[model samples]
Target: MTEGRKMRFAMVCSSNQNRSMEAHTLLKRHGLDVASYGTGAHVKLPGPSLHEPNVYEFGTPYKTMYEELRRKDPDLYKRNGILPMLKRNLAVKNAPQRWQDNAADGIFDVVMTFEERVFDMVIEDMNNREQKLMKAVLIINLEVKDNHEEAAAGAKVALELCKELEATDSWEDTIDDIVAKFEREQERRILYSISFY
Candidate 1:
C-alpha cells in the first residue's frame, strides 16, 4: 500500500523451479503483481545433487531443456518431476530470467528469496543497479527446504506473507513486524530482517 499502488513482489530460487514457482503461483493467484527468477549462472536441476545440476544458460527455452533432459535420462527426469516443473515454468516465462535480469525490469516493493545464497545474490544485484531505486526494498530470506512437499508448504507461507502485505498500509513497517514475529518463534519458519539494505 505504499503510495496506494499495488505491491510488486519478486521471488527467487537457485534454479527457478520448485520454490520460486510455488510462491509465484500463489502470489499471482491472489492478484498481486509478482515475478519469480533464479540467481544461478545457468539453469540447473534433476542432477545427482543440488550442487550439481545439468547446467544451461539463462534464457534457454524450457522446451529445449526438457528435450535434452529426456534424452539424457528419461527416467531420472520423470522421477524427479523435472519435466512437470519445466512445463510449468515454460508456461509462465519463455525462458529463465536471472535475478539480475528481473531487477533490471523494475524495482519490487519486496524481494523474497527461498535460499540464503539467493538472498546474497539479490542484495548484490540490487547494489549494482544502474540507477538507484530511491525506496527501500525489503529483501526477505525464507528458509525453505528444497523438496516438492516443502515447496508446497513454502507456497502457503508465501501466500500468508502476501496477505499480510495486502492488509497493511505500510510496506516496510509490515515487513519489519513480520520479521520480528518470525524471529521470536522457536520453530522453523520464515526468517527476515537480517540484511535488508
Candidate 2:
C-alpha cells in the first residue's frame, strides 16, 4: 500500500460488548487501521468508565474479561481516550453511520460480519445491489469447548473461510495466539479480517 492508502477494515459483531470490543482492541494494538461496530446497537465500547445495560446479567465472565484486559495493558484506556480527540481534530460532529445509503461512499477495504445470519444478510444485500463488492468474510466462533482439540477443529473451519476471502492467515487457533498476532503486527496496516458466528 502507498503511504496514505492503508487497508481499512470494519468488524460488525452481534454484541459490541464482548467479542467485538476485544477484536477491536486486538486489531488496534497490532497497528491495524480498523473499526468495529455491533449489530446490537446498545453495546458499549470497552473502557474504564463505559457502561452497558443488563451488565449485571452477564456476571463474572464479563467482569473477569474486562479486568484481565485492564490488568494486562493499561494502554487500552489511553488509546480509547483518543476517540473524542478525533472529533476535535476533524471538526466532525458525529461519526458516520454503520450502513451508509451509498455503499461506494464507505471507507472500509473489507467488511466482516461475525454471525452467519449477518453474513447471509450482507450477501443478500450484495445480491440486491446494496454493496458494491462481495468480499465480506463470515467469522464464526463455535461454542466454548473444553479442550484444544475441539477448539482447533472449529478454528480450522473458520480459518479456511478467511483464506477463501484472501485473508493473510488461514486461522487463529487460540485466543492467546490471536491476541499475540495482533500485538506483534501493530506497525503494519493489517486488519483482523474476521467475522463471528
Candidate 3:
C-alpha cells in the first residue's frame, strides 16, 4: 500500500487463459509485479461445444493441453488461435489453479478477479484460511468479458487502477469509486462495438 514499496498483484479468472492472462501479461510488461490464477476446477474454453470443450486440469502442463488439442482437431485449433493462447498459458505456468492453492501471507497486495464467481471463490477460500492468509490484502473484482479484445481492454483498465492505487494514500475513499467505474465500463461496453475484427 505504501508508494515506495512495489505492489504485488494477482489476477484471477475462470480459465486463466483469456482475461487474467491478458491482464497478467500487460501488467508485467509495464513493470508491475503480477501473477495470475484461476478459480475453476479445470480449464475450460470455448471450442467445439459445451459437451466437448477444451478441458484441462490444474497442474496439467500447458504443453500437454496444446498437444492434446492439436491431436484432437488440428485444423479447428489452428483456426481458433488456441495454439498461441496455449503458448502464453505455458509461459506463465498458471493453469486454472484454484484460489485456495494461491493462498499465502504477503503474497499479494491486491487481488483482482475477472468475474463475480471467482471473486467469491477467492474470498471464501481466504475466509477459510483466515489464520494463514494475509488480512490486509485488498481484493477487488472487475468484471471482464471473456474474449481477446475485451481482455485487452480490461487489462488497460486494470493497469490504470493499479497506478491510481499506488498514487492514493487512502483506499477507503477510492475503492468503491474504482469498483463503480469498472462496473460502468462494463455497462458502457455492452451497448457498443469497438471491435474492428
TM-score-better candidate, 2 vs 3? 3
State TM-scores per candidate.
0.83, 0.38, 0.80
lDDT score, candidate 2, position 105: 49
Cα misplacement distance, residue 102 of candidate 2 (Å): 9.2
Q: Which segments of model 1 are wrong by more than 4 Å? A: 1-5, 48-52, 182-189, 193-197
- Residues 62-161, model 3: lDDT tens digits: 7888888889888887788787778776786634455567644246777888778877877777666645432366777777888778888999988877
Work out candidate 3's RMSD over C-alphas: 7.0
Each model's lDDT comes to 0.76, 0.40, 0.71
lDDT of 2 by residue, 124-177 (tens): 544565443454433333232322243234334333323333343323334345
Which 10-residue window of candidate 1 scores lowest in summed lDDT?
188-197
Clashes of each: 0, 6, 0
Top lDDT model: 1
lDDT at 114 for candidate 3?
79
Quote model 1's TM-score: 0.83
RMSD of model 1, in Å?
Answer: 3.3
Q: Over all chains combined, what TM-score does candidate 2 have?
A: 0.38
Model 2: lDDT of residue 136: 42
